[model samples]
Target: MLLTFAILLTTAVLLVSLSRRLGLGSVLGYLVGGALIGPAGLRLVTDVHDIAEFSELGVVMLLFLIGLEVRPRRLWVLRRAVFGLGSAQVAATGVAIAAILAAGGLAWPAATVLGAGLALSSTAIVLPMLAERDLLGAPAGRTAFAVLLFQDLAFVPLVAAVPLLAMGPSSHGLPTEVPWREVGLGCAVIAAILLGGRFLVRPVFRAIGGARTPEVFTALALLVVIGTATLASLAGLSTSLGAFLAGVLLSDSEYRHEIKSTIEPFEGLLLGLFFLSVGMAANLGLAVAEPGFFALALLGMIATKTLVAFLLARLAGQPDASALRVALSLCQGSEFSFVLFAAAVGVGALDQEAADRATLVIALSMAATPLLFAASERLVIPRLGRERPRVFDRIEDDGAPVIICGFGRVGQIVGRVLRMRGIAFTALEKDPAQLDVVRRFGEGVYYGDPTRHDLLRAAGAERARVLVVALDDMEEVLQVVDIARRNFPNLKLVVRARNRRHAYLLMDRGVGDLVRDTFHSSLRLSELVLRDLGIPEAEAGRAVALFRDYDERRLVESHAFYTDEKQLIQSNAQAAEELTELFAADQRRLESEAAARSRVGAGD
Candidate 1:
């Protein structure tokens, strides 16, 4: 068992690394590694069933982590996309694919099953890729996520229907119809899980967490996941759904961050194994025997799914480019299709030969997805034409002395201060609504993302003496900083940092001056606290100044170790102790000086 595990890990690392270097995703690499080591190629491992079963944990964990990141409010905001657009995409794509299969001489019942499977895109594959490329916040990515959510919800009933479909029309004691009783049970189970998670899971975690033991907390987290999944399976629902619900329940919990960090490593490894199993299942021999047919099938599926997705996205009011991106990203078959097809074969709903062919098509489609996305990003979207310039671009540049990137709370204050000083500055903002509100009041806020080089240049970044970055997103801040440093080397940067970590990152990337967004206000609050505690205002201010100086110095000194977790933690602890001692010594010295002055005055 150890040997098999070792071989799998070694193969996964080497191939995944090579794939990454080749610009294909790690998923493709894992698939290739699986194929190379499985019965198809070198035959390193004979029994794939065991590996597949174990690898499913990866999918469960992936869903769990995704749930952790997804806030209920965000889901509510995306309700229209998740339900309306998602439902339409699934129904349309499934019906279209089913019609095609039926026309190709397959029975309607089997064809419907196949169509539903094919209509579903690989959420496991697509979501991670979108996240890796930092596109999840983009319109196309959000649309893809919405569709994936609905697909996951649909997986429960679809799996349930397989047995009924397999029973055929004349089976005794088995009605060939939708099982309403089972469906009701599944819904009840889902509701119970949600209610339990809301009322039960949080309190349990809180109790466990009060123990302050990491291992215990981790164990509880795993228990909750597995336990919920087990219950979900017993209730005739997908285990992934249960895990997802568990995650959503704890999404707003205080322990959410810790839970995510705990499970992330396990999730990555398991997900890799899952992909590897998928590769092992691929029937390359069949593909070789009917290359033309296999190629045509794969292409046709991709094209059909992409067309359906694109039309649905467009109908849902997405922009053409965004719709195209959504289509291209999700034009592949889902991992669930493998499970569904396998189950269908087991239940006699599908023939073995047909099942094998369908499995191969799904695998090939999954492999081609990353490449398809790349093509859309590099080739298709570019040809579609550049995005239209923002309203800010049409405005004339006055060659202002300063250019502020964002016009949120921080930017507004900065702009206000500059205006009060009679300093000419150009304020650029990305949000149309915010710009509209500010523009009505005759503020010079323009609608444009300053991270865009063209937009920055248009805003006279070249002529500006200073560029103020007040954007809330650290990624955008870093991008604008990089561009400004490269293109406008002479422009001084005054950035707003979200926190210590953000500040460290900015400083590491050569940002000279940055203000921790709320650090000064926090210090002011602390000063007021000291004043209220009977400390003189001047003394409180002096102490704050001293602490700030030491803190800044410590930040600079600790920047080198920031990337090393252990070293960073140790350094921070040591710095905190030193700061405490230093303040204590300073307080003692001040007290001594006051005492000496009082004694001298009394003697006089």
Candidate 2:
């Protein structure tokens, strides 16, 4: 088993790397790798069904992660798309396909099941396809996701109805009657998961989080998804649906990001395996034996679904290019259809021969989807005209002498001072909330992440005399520094450090003009306190200046041993002793000078 897995992984790595290098996506590579080592190819692993079942978990995890992003408010906002457009597309496509199949002399029940199954596009394929193109937040991508969400909701009922469609079942003995008990149990389980997600899940996560063991937290995250999925499966519901619900519930939780990060690798690996399994399960001989039939079926399915989806999207008020994109993105058959088809055959609603043929068509369509989208993107989308998606704001530069990366409090002050001096400067801020606030005050700051090289160049980093890294995020400051150093080698970096450690890190990174945000203010407060305690003004100023000089020197010295705790502590203690002695000596010198002046006055 291990040897077989080793072969699968090795094949995936090589093929995926080649595909990525060739500008084709990872999905294609996994599919081709699977085909190469599959039963129809080299026959490295024959039992594709087991692998398919296991890898289906990838789909569940994908949905869960997606759910984490789509919070309840966002989902509510998408209610129209999810219900109206999604339902219209599914119904219109299903009816059209079913009518065609019935006209071709297939039984109405089987045709209906096939059409419904096929009408539901592949969420597994479409989501990743859109993601690769960086379109997940675009109108077409959002619409596609909404439709897929509806399909997930529709899948359970579709599967449930399959048994009812089989009038006389000889194999596997599925009941013709609607199983009320099972249906009730499924609803009950869904409610339990929902309730648990609301009231129980967070508390459990909190307890586990309190333990401060990351592995255990990761394990619990997996357990939540798997456990919910298992319960849904036992209750005869869609496992992805259960996991999606769990994710949505936890979306607003503090732990969502951690859970997402933890589950993502497993999801990615298993998803690759799922694609591989699909490739392996493809019966290439059937396509080879009946070339004409195979080509006609494949073309017909994609064309019909694409047309129906495009029309529906248009009716839903989507623009021409976005509608076309939505259509092309989801023209393939779903992975869930495999389960539906298998159940249909088991219940005698569909023949094994028909199922095998449909399976091949679906697999091929999944493989072809990426190519189809790529072609449309390159050839068709440009012709239809492009509706530019919202991204980082375009920066307008007029040879600003200074480019401020962050437009928060520190950045705003810098901009204000520059404006007062009549110095031309450009400011960039990534935080939308901060940008909105700045705009209200009539500040001219372009919205963008300063860490991006493109945005930096657009903001006139090369022309600007100085690049200020005043971002609230310490990591972003470092990133800006690095980008400046690597890309614009001559650009000077004036960075603000949040603390001593941040200052030390900046020093290590070769940022010469570094200011600790609170250091000067703290020193001023200390000077004020000395004055309040009846110390002379000159003495107070001298004391503050003395401490400032000492600390600055100490900070630089400590940078060398910052990583070594013992050395840092020793240096800190030694600096404190030296500062005390210097203050004591200064006070004695003042007393001696006063005494000499008093004796001279007495002699006079």
Candidate 3:
């Protein structure tokens, strides 16, 4: 086993590096590596079951990390997408695929199982791909995540339904009666796991955290993941489901980030291993025997799922480009298909021949996922998105005094303030939905990317008195700042900085009047907390003002060292010490003044 692992790791590193150079994803490399080393090729590792069991750990950790990132509040905000669009996509795709399979002369029960299984896309594959391309925060990525979240949640019931579906089985010797009592008990166990994880896991981690040892915290995190998975398995639920629940429970915890960082390496390595195992398990013999049939099935499944996904996304009101991207991304069969099919075969619901064929299609689809994303990028996105008109041809220069680049949260607030002050501004928003919303509110938000020089000019950037760069993305913010600096040099620029780093970069690029997006809000929150803790309102306000002034000064002082990590660290430490001393001196002076006033009142 150790020798096999050593060979696998070595092959994965080599192939993955080569794949990177070739611009193919690591998933493809892992798959190829697995195929080269598996029974289908050199047969270096024949006992796939052992490797599979070990690789399954990767999926568990992956789901756990995903859970940690997904806050309950965010989920609630995306409830419509998650429950509505997600549920609809799953049902529609499942039924569509099942009907197709039944038309091909498969049993309804088996077809239904396979159809639902194939409807679920490879979350493990799709998410990493989306994140790699920096689209996880985009509309398409969020929509995909919502749908995948629903699928993970739906897996439990789907597994349960398999046994019930197999009650009147044919070929394989299995139980013929549905176990209602066991099913009820399983549901009860799942509830118990959820309740216990919610109430139990946090306190356990909290207790371990007080130790302040990094290794201890890491151990405790793994323990929570493994323990929850074990409990779920015992309760007849998917282990990945338990891990996911545990993650969601810890999402809002202080230790969530730490836990994620610690477990990420393990998750990544294990996931790659799992993918490699998938490649190794490919039945080359079956493929060689029926090449045409296999090809047709693979293409058919991809087309079916992609069509279903695209239609569902469109029905849910996503734009053509986003819907197309979502469709292409999710058109593959998931890792869960293997589990479902294996279970189906164990229960005589599906035959061995059908299972092997389905598995082959799924594996091929998984391999095709990266290619699908590439196709979306190269072919779909550019051709289908909102056509770029001769930059801002729709905008009329109304002699607007100000030009706002973005119409998102920060931009909207800035627009509101400017409007309240009777200042005229032309807002350039890239998102059509945002443009429509602001237009409905009687604001002139144009639909165009402001980074384009012609669009900026059309938005009256040349005539505008001030150019407010209130875009959310730091890259866009920097781009707009550069364009304004070069083209509209006279326009006083008020740029929003995503963070201190962004502010430093903007400063380096010669932009003045920058607002750190959350800096003021954080100061205000701190002031409120100070006031709540019995400090006088005036005193609290003064402290906040002093702190803000000191921080701003520090920012300016440290701007020169931003390029050098070591210098930046030293400068930050020095600035922090100086601020602490300054605050302490101010506190002493305030106390002294209070004492003097009290003394004067006593004498009187």
Candidate 4:
């Protein structure tokens, strides 16, 4: 039976749109759509395995983007948790779960596989939720990252553990899928990737950096990720691990943001596909056959897992409320549980009957996670009855020289800098508690959603000469920009972009002074001047100002192309080839200017 690609494409798009409209995660949409057209459902999308293989490019892109940020220096900050907290969580959870299963009359091998499989929380689902909720700048975000970091590190051991556990006491005629040669080779290859990447990846990037074409860099980054994953697959290792390693390799590159920009669209599409595939693969008949038993199992798993996770996080010093939040967030099982269970059943480890039971529980738990997150934030947090830190959204304007949209770390820094310079500024913060702290120091920050058309006028948008988009939520930042630009078109709109996509979006909206939130541009300016020459500090300052102006001009000009995405991509191909040629010519001009300056300095 053959299916048209057009139908598959339409299903994917329809599922995604429906999910977003319903305020559900795209993951659910993809899975539901996949199930409908799957062999068991409509039977129209049986050849979806090929689609799965292609959609995996999204994961490769995801990892590549992560790698661009993995500098060795940053690891020092997380070294304590990454090794101590992370290791403890994986080891304790895996062994404890394994022991429980073994006591329940399961083979040690099968139990171990199940435990390791269950330990992983979904990385794909958590980050965006945190960022969207404005929790990324909080203590919980740091703790979440520490736990997620540990979970990512656990992948290697779990992959290795699966095979060993499957060979339990009874030689139950289970055909071993992992050949000795492949396992041994995979372990060796993992070592090679870690060791070789540190030395080789940086130099490779330097040679390519001057190329400056987004596509070439995107292609190269994807190759590294996919190639590593292919090797891991060949060696009987987890491909996701290979993808994660690809991210660690480029964790410190100059064009990191650009790399991120190239990967985002692909990641969104494939991640959606992966979710859809999960849905299509679910056995609805099994779910329906024993609804009561399945419901109990789902509750039991979610409850047990959430309790253990909460206790672990609390022991690590998070407050009880924060611990509970963490617990609810991770109660869900992930897509890979299917992969792990399939292997267990194929081998003589788990009986098909037991595997089906576990599969039903995993699916229900995943479906319940988003609901749990929403409930915790809306119901649980407010009920805890802890007083919020502060409220400052009611401050009156007094002809403040600057206006800030958010009172987060970056906004605070800007406000403090301006204050020291004897410049008055009015800030707006939606988080009442956060602004309460700023109020004590006589800082003025009003609370209101800037997206409201009237809120901009109330915030003195007409009088304020400068408007700063300091909000962490990219979507909210855009809304603020749109409102501010429309009402006060002459206002200076300085913005903090979450990443390249955010930056590009802002550029399209006529923002001339957009700064990468994660990247310290002022520091980068100094670093760039030092790299080019040890020019005097004052001279370096002037050059940076010139370069900043030039970059802003380029961003403004590029807005026309970016607004029309199709044209932007079409132009990217041609622009990529010419960048090297253009860069060389610019270098010659810079060199001549440097020489002329040298001659003048000598005369002086």
Error of 3 at 45 (Å): 2.1
Estimated TM-score for each candidate: 0.67, 0.69, 0.66, 0.64
Which segments of model 3 are wrong by more than 4 Å? 168-178, 386-604
Estimate the Cα RMSD of every predicted model relative to the unseen true structure: 13.7, 13.2, 13.7, 12.6
Query: Candidate 3 lDDT, tens digit per residue, 90-186?
Result: 9999999999999999999899989989888888898988877767768899999999999998888888888877785556755567678768877
Q: Best candidate, TM-score-wise?
A: 2
Which sequence of candidate numbers ranks them by TM-score, best first? 2, 1, 3, 4
Q: Write the per-residue lDDT of candidate 1 for residues 454-483, one digit (tens) a residue.
A: 888888988889999999987678778877
Model 4 worst lDDT run, 10 consecutive residues = 386-395
Q: Rate the local accuracy (lDDT) of all candidates.
A: 0.86, 0.88, 0.85, 0.70
Runs in model 1 deviating more than 4 A are: 167-181, 386-407, 411-604
lDDT of 4: 0.70
Candidate 4 clash figure, as a count? 17
lDDT tens per residue, model 2, 1-604: 7988998899889998997676667888888889999999999988888998999999999989988877788889899999889888889999999999999999998899889888988888888878887687688999999999888889988888887887756477865467789789988999999999999999999899778888999999999999999999999788998999999999866566668878999999999999999889899999889999999999999999999999999998889999999999889999889889988999899999988888899988998888888888878888887844446788887898899989999999999999999998899998777898999989988988787888999888888899988999775676678678767988888999999998987887788899999999999999999999999999999999988998998888889889799988888889889999999998899889989999999999
Clash count, one per candidate: 0, 0, 0, 17
> Cα miss at 406, model 1 (Å)?
8.0
Query: lDDT at 50 for candidate 2?
Result: 93
